[model samples]
Target: MNFFSKETKTALQAKEAALQLAFAPVAFQATRALRNLGILKIISDAGRAGISLEDIVAQLTLSKYAVRVLLEAGLGIELLLVNDKKYTLSKMGYFIEYDELTRINMDFTQDICYRGMDHLEEALITGKPAGLRELGPWETIYPGLSLLPPDIGKSWFDFDHYYSDIAYPQVLPVVFASKPRQLLELGGNTGKWALACTGYDPDVQVTILDLPGQMGIATQKIKAAGLEHRVSFFTTDVLNENLPFPDGKFDAIWMSQFLDCFSEAQIIAILQRCMASLADGGRIYILEPFWDRQVFKSAAYCLQQTSLYFTAMANGNSQMYHSDDLIACITAAGLTVISQNDQMGMSYTLLQCVIK
Candidate 1:
């Protein structure tokens, strides 16, 4: 009766993969070294003919000894193929070298997660963003976004927008369907959605609600676009139970990649406050990458790992939710799920809800 079953003829391969996981940290460092030293590029340029270790050393300006060690590691990791003493990039290596998603994930991991992930155990125990202290003294990561090192901040924002920006197009039409006059962008990081909204319709006024630090960045970006007259910012931390939702009964509220940053109880509270503030007939548009809703196993795997970032560096108690759990929150908050738009770019799911 079990619907799930798979052949175990690949059992040996599974064990080998598990072994790879055990040495993954070192393998990751080696791959990073390969990328930074242009070893991958050299091997890739060599193409199917491959490049000898000496040639790799000559091209990358590295010592022969370093080249041998890194190349052997890459071979073991399957990032390189060695034949007749020449090395070539594997298919995986090609993606690591040129894929935009791979670049974003690598940069995000190195800049935002590497050190912080070490504190994951402590974060889990305390139910707080313990690793955020690595970046600053702030209790949470949001307030310190503006203070992060320039390169790290760039990686962080790149990872953030890369996913949401792609979904904006699909969501914009659904949001403006009723032709909302006043739209509230909850947790509008860097004012991307707000800018898009105002640009889509000059008549639609946009107000952003986020932490003061984030609002500062959002305000600058909105002003730079010369849409300041149509867009505004309100400072508030949703985690603060006392900070009620904006009094502005906006005709629409947009929360993209926002609710996943909080625990279920916090999500319920936020939704309730949103329902109270939302005007009659207005809808709350929720954009999230629900792992359980992902069609590809690789996408689900990636999202499952991203949840750890929440545990270690972001808020400790939140994660990439399952669609079922999110729907539960909506229902518990006295809201209706009018429809769910799936297949959004980057495996995102948009849930459109209105007050019950």
Candidate 2:
């Protein structure tokens, strides 16, 4: 069944939804302020009895006016419930305060994507990442990733790794089941998966193909993990179709949360290259969170919103894809999906393919 086949809201509900959309930014900032200012924690600690605005103000250095304004906003945002002049954390507030995923997503949106998102309209018109100027001078964000401010870089990688890392344990067994000794990982950011693969199979030799800056970080991580000998690095821009991939056949190729970083054309080009590099009978594993394949509407909503980030900040092209669109790219690249595993971790779908 189509997840959004029918309208579920009534006229009043639809109007309220429209109002929520209009005030989304205000609610977002208010919620973030409540969490960051430790107000949510104070209310949570107060337990079932809740606490008064005066008590909340007494616990923090913020003025009563400041605390009161945010608490009122929080009430409207549904992050807090107030009764008899007391405030208590709501279920939504709990997630905002303590959920790791929520924290990571919020931080990433604030630090990396917020300012640049202002240029989204311009980027859409120009077909370029106009908002990237907020960070550094680059056509796209990839080359400047390593050079990002420490806090920004941390948020970026935290968001990137969180989704993929959760699926590693479940996917490792699937990829290693065939016992591919010569494994190649495209866009092997920070060597996380390479490390996992080497640790999983002692005899396996892995190669990481990525841009030079990412290669540096991955190289350091591999060496720090004492797996340098088992892991090799191939530093080059994978988007540059003029440059050929390393001349070698692999038993299996793995790309985790990688292909979504490219546009449809680029994905097809990269896959075609992978097709050329695949050994006879070798398999290619692609792990992605296709929005349409999501089990929940919320997951699909998040993926769809992330596409705008690509428009304004990351690159003016690539996006979190729908499954059918991605599969079309696969077929265009002359490869066929032999197996597909959904709901691996979070919202990810792992596609196991072979040359057509």
Instruction: Give per-model CA RMSD.
Output: 1.9, 1.0
Best candidate according to lDDT: 2
TM-score of each: 0.96, 0.98
219 Cα displacement, candidate 2 (Å) = 1.2
| lDDT digits (tens) for residues 206-319 of candidate 1 | 889898888877888888889878998788888887987778478999899999988999899999888877888889999999888777777787788999999999889999
Which residue runs does candidate 1 get wrong by more than 4 Å? 1-9
The clash numbers for all candidates, in the given order, read 0, 0
What are the per-residue Cα lDDT tens digits for candidate 2 across 50-140?
9999999999999999999999999888999988988898899999998998999999898888899889999999989889899899998
Q: Each model's C-alpha lDDT?
A: 0.87, 0.91
Q: Please state the error at residue 140 of candidate 2 in Å.
A: 0.8
